[model samples]
Target: MTPDLAPQGALDRAWQRVADREAARLRDLFAAHPAPILPARAALARILAALILLGSAALTLLGLWLLLRALGLGGVSGGARVTSGLGAAPLLLFTWVARPRVPRVEGTPLPEAQAPQLHALVRRVGEAVGVTRPVHMVLSPDANAFMGLHGPRRTPVLGLGLALWYGLRPQERVALIAHELAHLKNGDPTRGGVVQAALNVLHQTVSVLWPDPVMEARAGLPEKLGNLILKGAALLPLGLIHLLLGLVGADQQAAEYRADLLAAQVAGSEAKAGLLDRLHMAHLLDSALHKQRHQPQRPDAFAEFRHMLDTLPPAQWAQVREEHARLRVRLDGSHPPTADRLRVVQAWPSEPLLTLSPEDAARLDAELQPFVAALEAAATEEYLYRTSG
Candidate 1:
């Protein structure tokens, strides 16, 4: 691989342009068939992911052999023994530290006991979307709803960011819930175990192999030379991570569109589009919360933001939509562009399969009353909406 010497951001921008083109291609490709399972690419991603971890495991085996030989199990002695032992330690440590484990779900827990009505509301939406498993819920202070798998059982988890949750009307919350739950059935790439584990392995390996600039700055000539060697070594895995991202890019984009399709089926098409409109105004939501966070006297951040969102000028909506199309920034780097997602959501219409009433939503809110105060307000993030642009 050629080392271009461009900073990482420059590299990211270059690849991102490549990614944007791919997204556009996939958006068109999926129009006739919105969500194909993409078995071929999925297989390739799985194989690549497996090889990454297997490579680590092979290194760990080598470390074991060296350790065994150092202990005189193979009758090796003295300088050889000392050298083998020294080398064995780091390799063994690396494998242990980086071994795949189920990642913990973020945000504070909202156990079924603590929020049973809330849990029930999510389940109602889940069943309508065809997810049969028991659901767990959590609360965050962000402006997003999420679907994550938790524990060894891979129990489905639903996360509600109170800011976004409170901002939504009862029916809108049904659309939000349905949209997220649909990800489980829509072939979300991150939900796949083999490929996700491999991604985790690749990320861990890259972090270890990539030379730290801070360390390089403080190094002597000998250490700098070692870093140079490491910098070269890092290219293999770094390039692999990029390759995997490219492989999954189009499929993941399709998965999101497919999830929107399912959301429209579960919640009405108009409601789903309305939820997306709120997402497009995420920056405004952040601005409202930021204003409250800095106020000398405290205010109900959710109410302040909700009022602002409710009264947003029609021109501002048009402006954000224009900005989205012009800039091509994704909600997250992983998502298809917001403008495109909105276009697809509006184009494909469906009747609501189920609905959440205001009374039911109130019951759910009452169950989550304890978390309301803590989760309602969030501090501003420079990339808060940038992350979800």
Candidate 2:
């Protein structure tokens, strides 16, 4: 007869079983949900469309010049020359569209030496997810974690939001890191970079070419005619681009689900579910508190958030949970609904892992204390400036 394992040992074993099952389930999901090919095809279509537009504009300009020369009206240099220049303006507009710079997000870097424990945790998660460690870590005021490529070499940067870090349990924090690391493993950052670059170009092109009614209202007849020409060039192409982006957006949502599944494997299903549920509850509670307090100005919004979470009535909390469960998947959003994520986690076996001791929690808090004041100060300053402006 075999001796029975301890409770914690048994729990770990169960989680491992669940993880193995989830891996097989993921394979099946991939088979069932074939990758969306529409977006890639659409991107190619947009490139071709842009080339055609340029070619047509060139030919049209040449035709007008030739027409003037044929009709023996070539002696009218000023008007004919102006017409030729104006006819070629659309091509110049396309060049401007491609040149709009992508803006950088601002955050202070937290060096590994400054937060070794945090770095250790990140490293652990990255190893579990089979991805290289992030090249840099950043701290921001928002309640989220995201990874992206930075600089000329496109090194990976992992951003940790202080609010979310403070709010989550140790295991849940691991789940979050694992989720971000999974994005790197899944090649999402590189793929998204290409997709986003294309979309940015499309957006700039549309804005430049789309007629502004207010500007048109104040313009003379010649300016109005120019605006009309710009609008005519942009309208149909912009519509097609938007339609393609919608399909790409769907693919992005699918990526989020895949990331969540991978995170569940590393952090266990229970922790992932708890994290999602708490995030949803936090959103609901924060919204309710803002309404009740008339959006009270606070020196530290995270502190205010903690107070609200602690003070929320049990009855109201239950109601919020109910609302969270019933929430529908929002197609317009990048991520799937919280309820759906929770449902996926619920199907997996679960076990608690990496519970933080008081000493551990205190150590983590101590490491973050120095940065907290600065982050809070920045947040306060931004809030005041925005409200006043």
Query: Which candidate tops lDDT?
Result: 1
Per-residue accuracy of model 2 over 1-389 as CA lDDT, tens digit each: 01123325776667545533443343345435433232353355446545544544565566656555544475757666666556546545455555425444458899989999888778877877888655578998666778876665567888887767776777788788888888888754224454555555667667877878898889999998898898887886587555545445445555776777778778887878767866765553344334434675554556566566656798987887786554433222356556656666666655534344557766887888788777765655554565566
Q: Relative to the unseen true structure, what is the C-alpha lDDT of residue 333 in candidate 2, on a scale of 0 to 100?
A: 34
Per model, how many backbone clashes are there? 1, 0
Q: How far is candidate 1 from the true structure (C-alpha RMSD, Å)?
A: 4.7
TM-score of each: 0.86, 0.68
Model 1, span 26-93: residue lDDT tens: 66655555554443675676788788878878998999998887787877878899899998898898
Q: State the TM-score for model 1.
A: 0.86
Backbone clashes, candidate 2:
0
lDDT of 1: 0.74
Q: In model 1, what is the error at residue 67, expressed in angstroms? A: 1.1
Cα RMSD to native, each candidate? 4.7, 12.1
